[model samples]
Target chain A: MGLTKSEIFSTEQNQLAQLLKALAHPARIAILQELMKSNTCICGDLVEELGLAQATISQHLKELKNAGLIQGTIEGVSVCYCINPSTWEMLEKETSGFFSSFKPAINCC
Target chain B: MGLTKSEIFSTEQNQLAQLLKALAHPARIAILQELMKSNTCICGDLVEELGLAQATISQHLKELKNAGLIQGTIEGVSVCYCINPSTWEMLEKETSGFFSSFKPAINCC
Candidate 1:
């Protein structure tokens, strides 16, 4: 079958994979970097900054929002976006834990 | 076009995305965790451990190896796999930088 058997994995494993999937695209990474660099809600500036069409940017933003990595608010006629701090922190901690698990052993492989 | 315009992003951004893509699956995460838990080269035991078919485990292992997250060598009649420490460290540093960029600003929506 061509389906992901998510039930077999631990919750942390699944959650990490979900977060990584959301960050797997270069466009999404760029968008997150832009938001972090701005340090404020960005509204209508991503298209010019990323050199991607508005539609593409919107799609990537939707994925990010769905992943809880970002949050958007309606400000006047435009939607302003910013990184979700809690989700970012969770991602950082979980990812760090995953990386930290692999301590290089002496004379291994 | 449906292709990723990777040229638009910085090298670090693209590299991070590539590494994340390799890790964007629960099975892959589980495999990495198992390898870390073993603390030694795993050979032919992942299928039993993960409950997935041999082919599926092999495919995930291939992706991990391609991403430089794991290394394998032929030992006797089987291939043994272990974590690639340098790539894991690089991944740790880069992902840490990415997450560290998002400082929660006061009164920012």
Candidate 2:
């Protein structure tokens, strides 16, 4: 496979792409929704909540953790996960900034 | 490769995933940022602005257009593109709702 070539872009562009890519999957979105709804640490509860395979849920959780969007803590044999508020806030700011930048042009389609 | 299996998710989940997937690539992100900054119709300016191949930029624009994030109009020899404000607003609402749902859990990591 070819390299990402992410260096060709600006740092902000790369950062934004990374954040969005982390959010580009349905399983991850479901995991996040479950986390938000619970508003509490989730320890292996995603398997039941999402009705997805344990390995699939674990993989999604790993992606979220790697993205720094969520944090996990070991609890016995299970790991409890929760949103990283700071990262969430940062994501909000970045996404809001991106989406709110456009103003309807006088004669745009 | 396996099928996407998007049917297992809720409508909201699928919609959000589609939008995020459309935004996941750096080329698409760059195109959006360029369009936002322009705040005017753009006709093939992305190739120069992004320093990417014409076909690459065109493909990225196709994804953005397919996601309804941008609208294109045919000019004499090129298609002019601009952000679709309504769709952008929808995206903002959906993404904001998702991210803002999390109130730090009482005893989360």
Considering every candidate listed, which one attains the maximal TM-score? 1
**TM-score of each model's chain B:** 0.94, 0.93
For candidate 2, write residues B1-109 as lDDT tens digits: 3556687899999899899989887778888878877776776888887777887778788889999999998888988899888889999999988887878866777
Residue by residue across B1-109, what tens digits does model 1's lDDT show?
Answer: 7799999998988999999999999999998888888876786899998889999899999999999999999999999899999999999999988888778987677
Q: For model 1, how does the per-residue alpha-carbon lDDT over A51-86 read when each residue is reduced to its tens digit?
A: 899998999999999999999989989998999999
Lowest lDDT 10-residue stretch of candidate 1 chain B:
B100-109
The worst-scoring run of ten residues by lDDT in candidate 2 chain B lies at B1-10
Residue B68 in model 2: shift from native, Å? Answer: 0.8
| lDDT at B81, model 1 | 93
DockQ per candidate: 0.86, 0.78
lDDT per residue for candidate 2 within A19-46, as digits (tens), equals 8889988889988888888866876888
TM-scores vs. true structure, each candidate:
0.97, 0.95
Off by over 4 Å in 2: A1-3
> Could you tell me which 10 consecutive residues in candidate 1 chain A have the lowest summed lDDT?
A35-44
